[model samples]
Target: MTANACAPTYSLPATSAPLPAPKQDPVRTLIDELLAEQQRLQTPVARFSEAHDRGASPALEPLYRDLIPLSKPGPGEQYAFEVDLDSCTGCKACVAGCHSLNGLDDEETWRDVGMLVGGTRNHPFQQTVTSACHHCADPGCLNGCPVLAYEKDPVTGIVRHLDDQCIGCQYCILKCPYDVPKYNDRLGIVRKCDMCHSRLAVGEAPACVQACPTQAIKIVTVTTHLNGQPALDTTAFLPGAPAPEYTQPTTRYTSSKPLPAEIIAADAATLRPQHPHWPLVFMLTLMPMAVGCFTVAACADLLAPRYPLLANLPASAPTTLALTGWLAGAAGLFASVFHLGQPLRAWRVFLGLRKSWLSREAVIFGPWFGLATATAAVPLASQLGLFSGSADVPVGSVSSALASAYSLLAAHYSLLTLATASVGLLGLFCSSMIYIDTQRHLWRAAQTIPRFFGSGAVLGFAILFAAAPTLPYFFALLGSVLFKLAIEARELRPLDSDDDTPTASFKTAQMLTGPLRLPHNLRVTSALLACILAFALTRISAPSLLAWTIPALLLASELTERYLYFRAVVAPKMPGVVSK
Candidate 1:
């Protein structure tokens, strides 16, 4: 304090210190603000611009509406997917039959047959499995569908697609190991056996079921099969059969003897052979990158304390950022490559602009992938070897400049990836918006995060967790599961909504706290008491009961929460019932 009194006033360092800055132009401010508004406006425009996103094209809706209700077995129309290993030759005749009748293209096979070889008789022991859709008791297809495009009749339980309403997300196909939903890139829609809806409406059998000359397939009600009837005893009802996990498909088939258990096992193994290839690869690629990506994100947060400053970050953070940003994206592209049957002709994938997220996903990621690569490599080169002894050393060297540019580019991709998630969320939002316009409180409410993030967190974790330490080499998966579980679990905790968001997921927490809470409470209390009695039991019980115990508690609580969300809210269709 005394120093001020002793010091003479130095002229305000007037080599002309920069003046205190004035407020910038409001026009500039508005323009800067418009950046995001510009983005929002561009999204709808981009959707319209895409050839495949048809996005309810007035032109296409009528065309789809014309094909609506699909020529299905109709609601409750019993349909069968039968295989005659004995009389049936692996001719793929039913496959071709389904195509011709359904107007499916060369790539789209409504039905296909596989060979299951078992029994001591070597070559002759092979049985042919010609299946379209098993229409299972639990159609994994129905449970996994995000758009709610699938509906099974309560009476007969025939699963059908609401063609006009379906967004063609391909999630149903992803859920079905059998790969029943066939995507038509030309139309950007999924084509599958609708149980010959039009024919079934008239009490006629579906094309494929009828086409089976050996009479291997027969359409029947769900009750007939689940009754522990003879139908369940046949080869048609073998373990791992095409039986869907949720829909309780009404279609039924008959067999002579449920082949020897070994043969049945072999046949079940043969039927659904499409092991998901991406999770393993993504785990390998993504896990390592998550470490890098997070480091990049975290470091950037530290260095750049502000928005523009983030753009000016050093190379190390960008390298990490770029690589991490690209991991999921590049992996997703790789996954899409394998998802298609003829990946060589993948260029044709882009041709359908009016109706494909797969296409949009492909389109968006292409540039994002390139930037991710260059950003990662250039920065890395400078960091390691590119600028060892230059005048500018590392920071001001030509290589460094290039590195900085790439680093910034990578950040943009990160933003774009967020945009992609937002786009997808919005697509789901559109699904909700569509339902809202209908005044359907059920769908309107169901439109919340549970459908996207909840289901995504659950299924993604399940898929991603398969690679957990005992699961896989990558923590990319486990970390995400933990992160998502932590965040989403919290989101599911509070029951907040008005029509505000429909059934609150937090209600699931309530269920766990109230009605369903007792079992877990007992388990927890008993476990605590048991620990006092014997700690060994806790370890033994945890893996066996508690592994599932925690997951089940969470899942049951969550699924019920989701179900309550679905059931409690009344849609306009079911008039006079108000949401509880």
Candidate 2:
């Protein structure tokens, strides 16, 4: 109903129509009384739930108590999700169902089914698990996103991804252990199971549940006093994530197998990090590495101002590279927007502060980068004599704009400078978290010093490599070497634990190319040693092979470590185990 479309605000002085008291029709009066009571009760519930979710609840807080409020399903309410694991038969009917139902593009799915194989090898049985957004309570996706595009229905507890509010960073993919978020390369956005909330609001089951063959999927409300709990049979395919804290996932899986303890154990350490996306790291750090590389090149040129050609190059170089760098960063960032379910309306991010850092970061990011980018071009303008830096201007006056410009530039660059340092560090943090947070001893080794230092060194050297022609980036390469050593040290350390996982991984890595470690390592080490000695004999002058060899050895080791890392992940044997 349209707002203000109802009766006037002022109450009429008690209706003087008592003479017409409708002849006191008892049945009609009783019906009117009953309808009024029902409407009164429902209207309060509806209002409170909506208001409470928006954090503006006075009446809602008490009426609903702790229940979450869900956005009402769209008009013509029709929706339900149903699943039967026993008869699922490991087929993927629902995936296609979701794709078609949601008008998802090719290579996109609104729902999917994963297979979990268990029951001791001899009596192995495969369970086909269908899945989509559980619309979780305490959704890892919701918590981990830097953008606040997710919403939960107070009544239904249906967590929703608001397409219009998303920027498509795909951070949700990492935050979710189920691997639900799919990267739509074409759209340059991260898409996931939207839970068919729209359809559900309109009284329909999610597309996947509707499409499941054998009646394997179903919608249910397994109610108890507690809220946000999934329906009794509902299960998610989360791998290495938190325990089901009754986040009230609406989608439930009916599995024949009992839940495992090991998976639950992994969840303790693997609850997704609050800052999983690390927007600050990207904005403040990574962007600068590229920018700083250009900056350093600019400085190097500035230092050699005596060289006419070099000085002229510096004048435009910063501007040109700054523009290019911004473009690349912007391109990547823009592509990220299409990943949102609703791209056109993304400004909702700035509305919340205390509850959302994503909004906070986004609110500041564009402007911060904008100011920083312009500040970067300032020295360039100075080069062109656009304005004299030393020109006398009144201090403390907005007229000069100096105070304001200084303050703004200073404020902007603080975060922007931080962006530079933390980019690689945050990426490392993510890499470490991926391994450290998971339970596999083999994978956890990634938390060791080697990975920590090595990744930084490798990335640093890569930057150096790109900027090699101008001047020395040796310090960067030196970092690369130290990191390489750390990698070696991590490998040499005894398997983090004697779990069969590490042993299996090592054995697998060894046998991957026929036989095992001895052959693989021996071949690699011998070739590398030969090359190193040959270069040593060549006196590091003519070939410049020294530069290549250092990274090569470091790279080879990194590749080997990566190979092991890949082998180390222990996938629960399901017919359709998730892997990227």
Candidate 3:
């Protein structure tokens, strides 16, 4: 067929004609039309819309209306949280409502639901706990804030944060046992649930209370009890919640069913050390070093006149010490500014001096820095002859008059030196008290005071010996390190006393001997090597290299030690969930 004329001619196939439409049955058409008509006739149903949903419905109106009076009571009454444990279904609707209604960050939640589990294997049990801010009668966050950012409503007893006043120090976070105040890093302030005060003022229920389908949460008026009547019973708190006696939280947990004695928070077993505060670490370490150097140098200068051996000390020694101390002090002060969220407003730090240790620290350090500068300036001024009498002296001036200028300058130098030394010591005392006032058991004055002073003394001697080699200073360096090591050795063992929190104490001990083992060993090794170098090299013919190396080593070692102190100490806090 392919030969010559039989070859096939390719062409597109002719398009197929469209098939005729199938006819529909009359009864089927009638049924389709009926279904369409029925759908069209039915009323439009309301669908869920988070934007339009205010959680207001006919069924919720009566329940929430009854709660309105409790939230907006008369002068003698105060608002408080009321929860019905039996009605809670762990649906987390309240959490969603709070986050959505408050316009909060997606990850930030003002309310949380936790599960408490207990009972024997034969009778396993579980209960859901929904908790938010209690607006405590004596809110620890309020009392602990250095800037007075938190205040309790005199009329409603709702604890509210003054965002404008906060510096985001987060001390309130440490102080609050309920762990309610949440730090907002973006705003550099702490925020918490204020019991939806604005809504309560406008006669609306809180988001949580309104959103709960099971009517688990309510608002109530808790009359201010007279003569110290306890506001809460033993069962008012979920097991492992912080004791109410401490903060006097006003939230009420109600359940008709008996909670098992063994019931405990799911997070009770978790224990970890506090997060590292690097700014505080640097501030603390450098401050003592500066104070030590200045005080020792001032004392040495004062004694130079009385002691012949001291008079023989190098002329550059005191000058070098004063200058180094001034530099260290300035660096420390700068480091402290970084710890404040509003460092530009650091001028306000002195405002709370009457009641806040943090304020006192600023007050004391301010003058301490001023005096330290004056002490350093005196020598420079004398060398420049700015304060020294003119070489000519007045032609008619008497001999005493000529001596008067020199005497005045001398008195100014001595007085300035003594003041700087005194203020520096006082500043150290104030620094220690800042942590002590938090009532954290680990930061007691007894432990911190010695540590601060001992570190100052050790670092001072090490630096001095490095600058100017001396037998006595070398011995002093050895003694201080030995004593300091002995003191720190006590922390290596777990605390077993009743007054201490067993888990926290043991955790601190374990950190010291476990995760921190390598750093701790390195610090010890560096310190011992420095000591050995000092002892061995002090006798060598050319010891100039030892001058800088020994103190540098000692400084590094002390820095390591301070890091451990901050990292190992366990602060009391709410139960934290342990991650699997």
> Which model scores highest in TM-score?
3
Ranking under lDDT, best-scoring first?
3, 2, 1
RMSD of 1: 33.3
User: Which sequence of candidate numbers ranks them by TM-score, best first?
Assistant: 3, 2, 1
RMSD of each: 33.3, 15.9, 12.0
Instruction: Output the worst ten-in-a-row residue range by lDDT, candidate 2.
Output: 266-275
lDDT of 3: 0.75
Query: Which candidate tops lDDT?
Result: 3
Model 1: per-residue lDDT, tens digit, 1-580? 6998989886665565778899867565776878868655532223334524656542343222111233343332444554445566666656766788788787778676665545666534556666666665556556554445567665545567766544554546645545577776776556577767666665455666545545555555433353343233233353434333323443333456555544432322111112223432332233223323433344344445565545554444455444444564466456545444334445643433333334443454455455445545654655565544443455555566665665565466445434433443333333333223323223344344333344333333332222121222123333433443454335334544433222324334444455545543543353233223222322343343332232233333333334333333322100011112
TM-score, per-candidate, Cα-based: 0.38, 0.50, 0.79
Candidate 2 — what's its lDDT? 0.47
Q: List the residue pairs that clash in candidate 3.
A: none
TM-score, prediction 2 = 0.50
TM-score of 3: 0.79
Give residue 494's error in model 3 in angstroms.
1.4
